[model samples]
Target chain A: MTGVSGGAGAPRLLQVAGLSAGYSGEDVVHDVSLHVDEGEAVTVIGSNGAGKSTLFRAIMSLVTPSSGTVTFDGNDVTTTATHRITRMGLAYVPAERHLFGDMSVAENLLLGSYPRRPDPERLAMVYDVFPRLAERRNQHARTMSGGEQQMLAVGRALMSKPKLLMLDEPTTGLSPLLATEAYRALAELKAGGLTIVVAEQQVPLALELAQRGYVLENGRFTLEGTTDELADDPEVQRAYLGVA
Target chain B: MISALMDGVVLGLQYGLLGVGLTLIYGLAGVINLAHGQVAVMGAIVVSLAMEADVPAVPAILIGLAAAAVFMLLVDATLMRAVYRQEGESRILLGLLIMLGVGFVIDGVLEWRYPIQQLGLRIGGEPIPILGVPMSTGSLLATAVTVVIGLVLVVFFRSTALGRGVRSVIQDEQGAMLVGIDPARVRTFVFGLSGLLAALVAVTRAMTGPVGVSSTISFTILALIVAVVGGLGSVSGAFAAGVLLGVVDRLSSFYIGTYVTTIILLLCAAITIVARPAGLFGRSH
Candidate 1:
């Protein structure tokens, strides 16, 4: 795991302080606070109902934070629109994948660069990351397998050249081998200095890819530590790592 | 029979233009603008009045088109804004009711001011002979305009970034928003486009034949039928279905009777709904 050198002076890419958000009037995420420094890979590991997704949504401004300040690159963006937040270099990939099923894979990737002219070099980089996507570029997104679709979703986000990429439950329905493949791709991306905030139920993979981990339970972060520390923690192993 | 078929093809093209706007609105915003027909009537009436006031044909048509686009944009900004955040069945129902009320208001004003008058454009040149049939010059001009508009729209959706954004919204609003496309702005632009298409339909209809104030209801019904039969959100489907229905309507009216045309069109719509609820080219939700 990469050491947390950002400690006090390193520039924070995203800072969320006291964020509370939910659907309708019910709060799903309560007073959650976290920060990701530039080039750091952070993971929020939790169960299905632990509000990990909500926390990510709140940070992306997909869900309005009831009371909080989300500072991105020293600018307060708690109340900014989702698209504006995306334009400011924060990209989010939801659990559903949300690929336009009827559209071609290329079209879906191109749409990620919306409100901005698509750069061929960036597109080439996405293609280089996921060679399977390049093979099926002309095919409809619906035709791809689950693993391929997930890759396409990630590739599409990369098209925007986002500085920080937030992913929700990326390995939810994947087989072990496919899940490993996805995590390896993400690990490669992290090595390239892309700051990542991944919310996942897959504890081992998330911990393996992220330098730091946060254990969330019932809309709040129950524990936070370096990946090695959390992996060694008894409670985390018993609950998430499935250690008997 | 050949002439009837040709006439149907021309009318189908016009109906396709009309249905594209409604389909786009439904696809992107999930709203059915019930006042769509009335808006077209408003445009035709404006053109008629303008021509009566000695405005040239080109200028009058342009003015009417502009008026319709502006009016619909205003409607979207003020009235539709109330239901912009709504979703699913409630949003559709609310939009339908609100636009229906708008339609009634517009109809009332038009009737009071214009009376039960029939207005049409005059074709300057002689009718062209094609395949032993005489085609009115005005119909040919209207058909040409319809083709041009349709091509332009195709290019817009295929090539332009804004058009791609609109398509993204239609496919998945949440996904589009995640990528930083404003769904609200896209909806507003779609509403304006819908109005422009409606105005084009009005101009074409007026050129081909006379349009009365009460004709708005028929136009709305026909446009809805065409849109649904083509598949609600598919523009190409709308165009195909429009042309098919147009040909059917003309042929059936020539053989069966004028009164039976509406019944036949409705029956075709019913069949389309029963066989493929998503329309011919629509992706089934």
Candidate 2:
């Protein structure tokens, strides 16, 4: 909440207040609240099953929130349909990376601009970001390696030119080097003025990319601070930073 | 021998068309529409009544197709609303039961009201010889129409934005939504298209023989088998399976008997399912 104000004049781009969402009418993430201002990079660091995915799903309306509200770019989107929310400039890349397995890489990227024709500049930008996608444009997405598929997922999200991009555990299966490379790309996107919210188990990489972060433990945010503060916190170091 | 093979190819094209309609709807909506063939019969009844009222052949066929399309759109918006609300197995089962009831109602009404009504399109012309077999004008026309429509559908699913959106929904529903493609809209559109394709198959079938109320169940069975063999969601697969099954149907009928041909066809579908559960083109999850 400290960085909810994007400077003095930049309005808050995304705000979630008291959101409690889960599957089967039972709440997994309870009364969670967070906000990311325009052009800011925010991270939610948590262990497995910490409800990070649930929170993001709640924001996207993939799962109905038992209570609370999500406001994006000044609109109440608590009950908005998932596709409608995406159309309103909030793109999400889930941990599963649900790419169309049978379709080619080019088709997957092309579909990212749904209802709107693919913009040449945006397509070029995505290909520039992940050149492997360009090389395998005609190859089926199912055939791509795990790291390549992750790249395609992020590339697809970027194709929409969204105002705020949310990702859940983007480094779930990547090698250490590839995970670092993935963050490097994200860092470049942040440098290019993109607003991002990433939920990650990898605290070091996430802290490096995000300016501020919230530590989520078992469905609630237990701590909130700038990246520097989070990196130095004793609990965060012991639990996530691997610092004895 | 050549004649039977050629006729089989012609019939196979129509089967391909029918399966594609059914396959697409199942892929997108997760519903196996039991009322599909009955709805097609309803459209044929519309065409027959339109022709009785002095409407020309082509316009009457167009009106019938539109009627079927509109009827399906209505069903998708209204009756299928409850079905769409459910998830996974319940969704599919509920849709099946609802559509079955709709089918029974349509069958009862059509049989009671128009017991003898049938659509028979007779294309009067010389039998054109091709590849050593003389082909009837009606068969040729049906084949031509089916081929053109098939090619159009392939291009649509392969190239067009709306078509790709439909495919995207079938492939990964959540991913489709994240990309701003509404699964509901895609389902509705595909439902209407399914109805139209079903009616189109009826019209094409009428070229060879009369399509009456009795043809409804058989049409549904054929569509189901073809769709299953075609992998349930692949358009090109439907056509390929249709063609292969069509040849089998004709050859079996000629060499053995019409009674046994159906059993053999059923066997083919069963074997396809047992051997390759995903059908020929469906990707295994």
Candidate 3:
């Protein structure tokens, strides 16, 4: 169990205790426990196939946990449906960036705000975050470049005005500049007091923007500390940062 | 010629209504409902029975539509639910076979109970002359109803949240799930709506001309042709193709012979498949 306190008396916004999730009766995520307090940005950094995505999916209720309890904002949500979990102010931006290719960018953004009324202010905020999206609001999402689509995916998740936003591999295929821009957006969101949980293979960027992070290997948390501590850890450097 | 053209337009609209339901179901649920025409027949049977029992035209039609919708909901819940759980070719093949059996059962039951040769609505009014062509009150009313239903569907898909949710499912099922749209609920709603549209077609047929129990197969074939010609999932494409085929059918039957009309329709469908396999308006996947 890794307890990164939010503040002196801040309430815990999310708590996962003994979560064991899997596919086809075989456990992949084994007895993982973690917590995120209010106004915190946490990252789970791992290599490919380390089960980081599965952990996030379990948290979003997209995948059923074989055994565990997930408490979000003081309510048990381990067995809840994915949409219900989303409606409860937790938004997930999946890795595939599953934008309705035929639908316009504006329509995709509008769908993000589906759990609540479509607010013009939210739309404006999303556009403000990604000015290129504003320029191509009426364009089909499929026609956009990879970087723009990533931006759109992040912006779409933000439209829901969720208390906790979980993004899976937000900068996976972006150019160096675009990845920086994405991290900049995340930093901006974190600065705005939005709690975020990001699962990423991009170790340095994830560590840089997140206040605290967990190093995950084989579906288990290997190390947990503040970003500075993890960056300074010799084991993390040899494996993730390519430093010996 | 003008009267034939006008009649063709009306018939085209009816075909569009009939095909739209099938298109939507296929587009969203990926299920080809072989029971579609039989469901319409069931609705027609209800209307006919209600009329025989002294029910008024409006109420009888409404009752029939509701019954068809309810029946489809049952079909979706009981049969299609299992079909959807399967994957790939198995899903398609199983859906076809199951719905085919369902259609046959419905047809057999209706034949056994009703035993009626033909049924027609008893709409009372004088023929109205338009551009020197006399159009019956019933035909005009059916056309008007078709147009209204089409408009309502357009608005529903464009403006309503539920409708948007359905579209989202159509585009990407997993993505829709992530955004909190339940695909199962959307599927059920679409299946029910499809049945309601078929029921509307039955009522329109009863109003404009006699609808025999044996005509279910013909109606299904016609609707399938329209859907394919228009592009299976595009509503506007289906409507346009229905109108085009209806006009072509009427013109060919008049100029050549009734036998040649079927040949021409088949040729149109074949050409469309060869040229644009996705149908006229369907996005090429």
Q: Candidate 3: misplaced stretches above 4 Å?
A: B1-3, B122-126, B129-132
Q: State the lDDT of candidate 2 residue by residue for A179-232, as single tens digits.
A: 998999999898888999999999999999998899999899999988888999
B-chain TM-score, candidate 2: 0.98
lDDT computed for candidate 3 = 0.86
- The weakest ten consecutive residues by lDDT in model 1 chain B span B115-124
- Report the lDDT tens digits of candidate 2 across residue range B26-100: 999999998989988889988999999999999999999999999999999999999998999999999999999
Provide the TM-score of chain A alone for each candidate, in the order shown: 0.95, 0.98, 0.96
Residues B159-252 of candidate 3: C-alpha lDDT, one tens digit per residue? 7778778888888887887777888889999989999899889889888888867878777777788888998777888899989988998888
Give each prediction's DockQ, rounded to 2 decimals: 0.80, 0.91, 0.66
* Cand. 1 Cα-lDDT: 0.88
Candidate 3 chain A: 10-residue stretch with minimal lDDT: A1-10
TM-scores of all models?
Answer: 0.97, 0.98, 0.94
- For residues A1-244, write the lDDT of model 3, one tens digit per residue: 2555546467788999999898878878888988888888889998999998889888878788999899999999998888878878888888888888777888888888885678999899888888999999999998999999998888877887899988999997899898989999999988888999999888899988887888888988889998889999999898888896
- Candidate 2 runs further than 4 Å off: A1-8
Model 3 lDDT, residue B228, Cα: 86
Task: Give fnat of each prediction, in order.
Answer: 0.80, 0.93, 0.58
